[model samples]
Target: MAIDVRIPTILRSYTGGSKAVSGTGDTLADLLTNLDGAHPGLRGRLVTPEGGLHRFVNIYVNDEDVRFLGSLEAKLNDGDTVTILPAVAGGALGFAAAHALRG
Candidate 1:
């Protein structure tokens, strides 16, 4: 199955600055492998050493979160659009709330 992967700005370097790239696979994991073959070093940033997805990154298949869809085992179809987004840190507000609650 041919899939369209939307690359985030930070990871665009792997695709030679391309915002979107195409790959093929039956599952999300296969798609990543296909992408890595064409764009070396890209998979490492999204997947962990144990072969699971990295917590810092979020992936969605056609607007649905892959995590809720069996993660790496998520099924994909041809022409599906895969979106990769880096998790936004809560930063200051989160830190302040945690500190206040601790007190």
Candidate 2:
């Protein structure tokens, strides 16, 4: 299946600065492999050495979190949109904002 993947800003270098790329696969893993083929070193940042999705990375299939849909095994279809995002934690004002919200 042909899929459109949305690449995160940090990983855009692998894609020649393109924020989106096209790949073909039946599952998310295959799609990523295909992407890596065209954009070398891209998959290594998303998948771990154990062949699993990286802990700090998040993937979504058609707007639904892949973690809730079989993760890397999540099935794909033509025209499906795959989104990759790195899990972000505290920001510049995170601590203060969190404390303010807690009060």
Candidate 3:
């Protein structure tokens, strides 16, 4: 399946400053892996070394938080929109850190 992933402004640098990117996969994990393949260091920001989602990040599928649903195993249909959100502490500082680290 092909899905649209909305890259938050804080993490756009990893996608070469793209706000949205399209990837093909059946599950969220696969989609993320594909994205990381295209944008180095992206997977590390979203998922931990233990293969779990990072605590500071939340992934939404079609406006529904995937954590409340199935996490990275969430099923993705064609055209689904996945939004990557990184929790912010101090607005600017958090965003800047996300950009620098993920970029």
Candidate 4:
């Protein structure tokens, strides 16, 4: 299946500064493999040596968190959108401060 994978700002270097890339795979794992073939070293940042997603990384398929849909095993289809984002942790006051800055 042809999939559109969205790359976050921090990882754009691997994609030659492109924010999104196209890859082919039947599952999320295959997608990453194919992606790495074209964008070498990209997978290492997303998957760990243990063959699992990095703890601080979050992956979504078509707007749904893949963790709820079998993680890397999540099935894929043509035209599906895959988003990879870094997870952030902060206390309520920290969040308020960040949000206040946006005002």
Please give, for residues 45-67, the per-residue lDDT of candidate 3 as tens digits.
Answer: 89999999887898999989998
Please state the error at residue 68 of candidate 4 in Å.
Answer: 0.4
Candidate 2 C-alpha error for residue 21, in Å: 0.3
Candidate 4 per-residue C-alpha lDDT over 3-98 given as tens digits, one digit per residue, 9 for 90 to 100 = 999999999999999999999999999999999999999999999999998867999999899999898999999999999998977675776677
Candidate 4 weakest ten by summed lDDT: 88-97
Question: Model 1: what TM-score?
Answer: 0.87
Off by over 4 Å in 2: 90-103
What shift in Å separates residue 18 of candidate 3 from its native position after superposition? 0.5
Candidate 3 clashing pairs, residues 3+ apart or interchain: none
Name the lDDT value of residue 85 in candidate 1: 98
TM-score of each: 0.87, 0.85, 0.82, 0.85
The CA lDDT of each predicted structure is: 0.95, 0.92, 0.88, 0.93
TM-score of 3: 0.82
**TM-score comparison, 1 vs 3, better candidate:** 1
Candidate 1 residue spans exceeding 4 A from truth: 92-103
Q: Provide the RMSD of all predictions against the true structure, rounded to 1 decimal.
A: 3.4, 5.1, 7.2, 6.7
Q: What is the lDDT ranking, best to worst? A: 1, 4, 2, 3
Candidate 1 has its poorest 10 consecutive residues by lDDT at 89-98
